[model samples]
Target chain A: MKKHHLRIPGPTEVPEQVLRAMQAPMINHRGEEFTSLFKKVSEEIKEVFQTKNDVLVFPSAGTGAMEAAIANLFSPGDLIVSFSCGVFGDRFADIAEAFGARVERIKVEWGRPVTYEIVRERISKDTKKEIKGVLFTHNETSTGVLNDIKSLREAVGDHPALVIVDAISSLGAVELNTDEWQIDVVVAGSQKALMIPPGLGLVSVSERAWKAVEDSKMPKYYWNFKNAKKSLEKGETPYTPAVSLVYALEESLKQIFDEGLENIIMRHKLLAKALREGLKNLGFRLFAQDSWASPTVTAVDISDFQGKINFSKALKNRFNITVAGGQEKLKGKIIRIGHVGYVDELDIINVLSAIEMILADEELFGKGVKAAEKVFNEGVEV
Target chain B: MKKHHLRIPGPTEVPEQVLRAMQAPMINHRGEEFTSLFKKVSEEIKEVFQTKNDVLVFPSAGTGAMEAAIANLFSPGDLIVSFSCGVFGDRFADIAEAFGARVERIKVEWGRPVTYEIVRERISKDTKKEIKGVLFTHNETSTGVLNDIKSLREAVGDHPALVIVDAISSLGAVELNTDEWQIDVVVAGSQKALMIPPGLGLVSVSERAWKAVEDSKMPKYYWNFKNAKKSLEKGETPYTPAVSLVYALEESLKQIFDEGLENIIMRHKLLAKALREGLKNLGFRLFAQDSWASPTVTAVDISDFQGKINFSKALKNRFNITVAGGQEKLKGKIIRIGHVGYVDELDIINVLSAIEMILADEELFGKGVKAAEKVFNEGVEV
Candidate 1:
């Protein structure tokens, strides 16, 4: 079978080791073996999230984690400031709204990051401090923008509002100091930079978030944080967990720790830098602002291309490379190339070469490849 | 490494083919290949469910699907009747109550099944007919009892209360005609008889359930049936699905269909029968009623055995055989041997032999093995 490059923002390429780990025989979820495995994975996940707080793993997708954050921490009609810069950011707001939280969205333009100024203005404007929480997406997958979570948290200083973040596509590939940044709740998925399949939703909750959970009256059973915490104490989940995915996660976590978290984040940064430069050399305008460009995914403006959908289709059908199209309003106007999880510099090169072949632009291809090489040669530390 | 028998009710032993299927490389969830695979698997799942209605798959454990059923079909304060027979049944009621639904429970004895008489009397006595839905467990894993869902549905007699069943531990290993029985919604888990790991929650929604969903006011976003239905139109899930689990499900469904659903259910029946007879020969009484005993798991009373916990632990530690101990009220009183999902007569023999060895009774071991052999040789058709 022809190899297909999966370049979606999340559900990034899973490594062979991780896939093999998933093939391990199923074990009894409530047994000692599983309990140990669950505990180990939970601890490893907490380390990755850079938090000393409790981390809950659910057998669900990232959106479910997003929902859990809202459902577990906020009651109906509770006010929250949602910083929406992209689709995923908007989804956080949507989930809060769906659960009856009154979401006051600080809607940034598409392809822009949630700036500290916007967060400060939103929180400070709430003089009565009616807002019970602040929701932000650390890495906006759709627009390929990484928000300054630390700055956002600082902006909310002593406001008594819980700070919740969607770090689905960023946790493993980007720098997220959950504890240092005072993030009350941080949500992530196994499918992204964790290099596993889409099944597990990982969330870390601070003492402050626990307090909110105590006061929260949102109707929740499946996503109950308290129940998950109780089960976690026993080294088990409240319900049946995705055993295979947990196995995959264990292997991936081992690999990540072996490689070191700092190295993984650096690798993502270097590869993302090269990818952005390569795309620019190939006559594509970068969608996200340079300073806040995400190291996980890079959005490119393909509006100049005739039939952007056809271009994306050709990239997949003809070249065996799958990339993401713009979601919602940005559909057909941009294409996204993900460089998270198991991806490396060579993978970026192959994607660029495939795009070159599809566009039949040999001259642009050479320039793009050279630009990427130059960036790699510069030693990638910055 | 010594192979271990995973005898849990839901996450029973997965077949090698299914495990290998899960090792397949990741693909784009929104792409054509995934769409085709999604459609094919969805159809096969419906076929297994014996339903003409829409079956939605969630990246969650069965409890998530149970929550979806309550959160989607019933609004806050909506009256529902929950027939509690065992732990899983109680959980369904708890989920409904958690979501703010008023659950009028028909609480039966732990090992007793929800009989048609109980359901009939409950519904008939409610002259006001305020209950909007009836929740029942087709197979209660905790107590190893199989409720009479068909008779219960008949007892409802067009009361406008939607009949929802939890078939998590019984879906594939037992016979369930969703359409014929007119179940409004049926929830299942992949880890059970589907022969996959625990992650995907499959739910079949009848047309009547759709009407209830439309009028329901409970908060939901990630588990929204309407969004899931919309995505199903495009042969996708509303949120990212557990892709590897879906691949495993595809293989498992193929194996199930190839074996024929009737033969599969018969295999479970035969194994369950052998296990029960074997346990009885060893001087253990069956916990569940003979007529309502589940074919998936057999609950054996171990009150005669001192240190039941040590006996169970020895079975696992010494013989590499794992069986579920009684949960909640039944703790230390019974041990459950799962004969569902990829289990056969030999597996039953192995478990019985292990138990006999743990008990250190030669006479009991000989009698148990003989009883199992006799049942197997009798052709198991009955």
Candidate 2:
């Protein structure tokens, strides 16, 4: 079989230019050239985050940025409200618990977006202002759901708790107004919608979070926002950054700005609609609620396969098509097809045809690739 | 001016193979293909680390691994012995303190190595068992000094305190016996002697350090040893790894193993000695003491230039030779030339001639590039 197309959530397919940008000659971290590069990149990153406050860049995955947000925002034993819908959400609770924080999870079912009412209820229960923060994933990739962070923040009015959103898979693919949503800490990675590799984690902070940093008792060094902010003031990193990746990011962000934020989000939305409609017409059920579905990934319930159709395994082994499987309780019950950055209608049609052929080969579906091709042709026009 | 040769501590010149490796198609984090890839890479990383213990891969610089070490080892109000000789040593102290660890520093002058005598004195003074751990940098890149870690470990004797070593700049370039030296925690990064770009950081833990992880109370999520270990058991990262970097690391490790670790270390030593001898023959003053000089980098006083030469800046501007400047208080005083991974006699000569040209350009020294060429020819057998 030929090399499989990557249709999973992230490390998303990086554009060729971004890859070439990383191939540039290395620079000394302390040199004037690097300082200028870092400063421009840092300032440009703020435009994407839509925040005037400091944005710390780390050389880890989105998870590392999540850890940094927790480490730099609160002391040990501080009460934190974690909104849970899927694996990433649960991860926040686990991270907070490991850090000695009392994590109160406002749980929602997997594939379902967490309502603002639950968050409000959790905050109201903490009358003593002991809840230092509320943690939420803006986009839950595992479940293909996007939480309404704007409404959640509005619901959290007058509360002393800071709102932290994990925008790992959604940042560039969706509309994320960090300042508008009053997101105290919004964390993202270079992978996913940013159309780059998975090494760089970014966290944009608000003034409120900066104040919390002063009193945070957790131990942090490499991911220290304070040190990063100070060095950023001089257009540098406290230590040698992932210089190659930083160079790649500079190029990626340039493309992002050129496409414009609204246009990017609209592209994802339109692509997501096309994918969902195609799957539905082929008798598949989407995992996420219609209103809350994520534009990045579309998780479809594939339980109706009649014969020997192992949908997830078949796509990979037969067609060299790499898609995601169900996580935790949903394992083997769903297949997540991605339509993220650097992907277009042609790519989507190809993936859809691959899936169609596999399903027909197993004697589960008979319409073949024509339905997917028609959908793509129609979808591209819109 | 042409592009500067990155001959400082890290973010070294990436080999073409490693760069090509990073050009692979991105895989979804939750996909079956990634799981297979993740497992293969994780096990291979273990082979490089030479540990049965899980190796956690992070996407930051070496500092991220250092932060991971701090967050996973000690808790608030815990006392730890920190040995300081250079900027990285100073960093360990800062990180420990940031995590609420009471750091007692055994200070050594910059450009000097820490002696067992100092370690013994510090260990003897902590009679109350208040010291929770000791942090040391295996090769202080800033000073071009290597400490006697085994001797320091012997000084600790039966102490319960953990021994952590920051082996960032030394790992692939210098010989390190993490298991044999009773090092509780050892940290390294990809960009230094590893001949890869600056994205991944690696850490290995002894059984003793694993036990200390249970007592660690600092806030952690992405860097959580427990979570990473759990995922590593299945040959996957807890979160999305920098997949492309891991691919690069896999190729890098193959080269390292093919050359053999001992040979790699020996090559570094021979090159370092030859560089020093050539500098000495050229009437250059060595900043680091002979006994404690690092095999990776050679720090020189450049006192002969007095106020006449800005060695670091001049070399970069004139010949695109990027040597390291004196950091912190050592600024404008010393020039550090690193001959680490993928380096040969030619690279040494290239740097040496650049230095000689800079000196001659200022008329501080006679035309020494030709003399240095002869000295390199005689001194370096490689």
DockQ of each: 0.01, 0.01
lDDT of each: 0.85, 0.79
- TM for every model, in the order presented, reads 0.51, 0.50
lDDT of 2 by residue, A1-382 (tens): 0333688998877876888898889989888988888888888988888888888898898899999999999999999988999999999889999999988877898989988788778777778888899998988988899999898888788898999999999888888899977889999999988888989999998999999999999989988889999988898888878999888889998988887878778778866876776576567788996799998998988777634688777777755668898888888788788878876544554465456555542232212223433443343343
Candidate 1 per-residue C-alpha lDDT over B216-283 given as tens digits, one digit per residue, 9 for 90 to 100? 99999989999999999899988788999999999999988887899888888888887888788778
lDDT tens per residue, model 2, B277-361: 6677567889897788998998998756768888887877755678888888777778889888867544664565456545453
lDDT of model 1 at position A8: 86
Summed backbone clashes in each candidate are 0, 5
Question: How far off is residue B130 in model 1, in Å?
Answer: 1.1
Worst 10 residues of 2 chain A by lDDT: A361-370
Residue-level lDDT for B242 in candidate 1: 90
- Model 1, residue B284: what's the lDDT? 81
Question: What is the C-alpha lDDT profile of model 1 across A39-154, one tens digit per residue?
Answer: 99998888899999999999999999999999999999999888889888989999999999888888999888878788888778878989899899999999999998888899
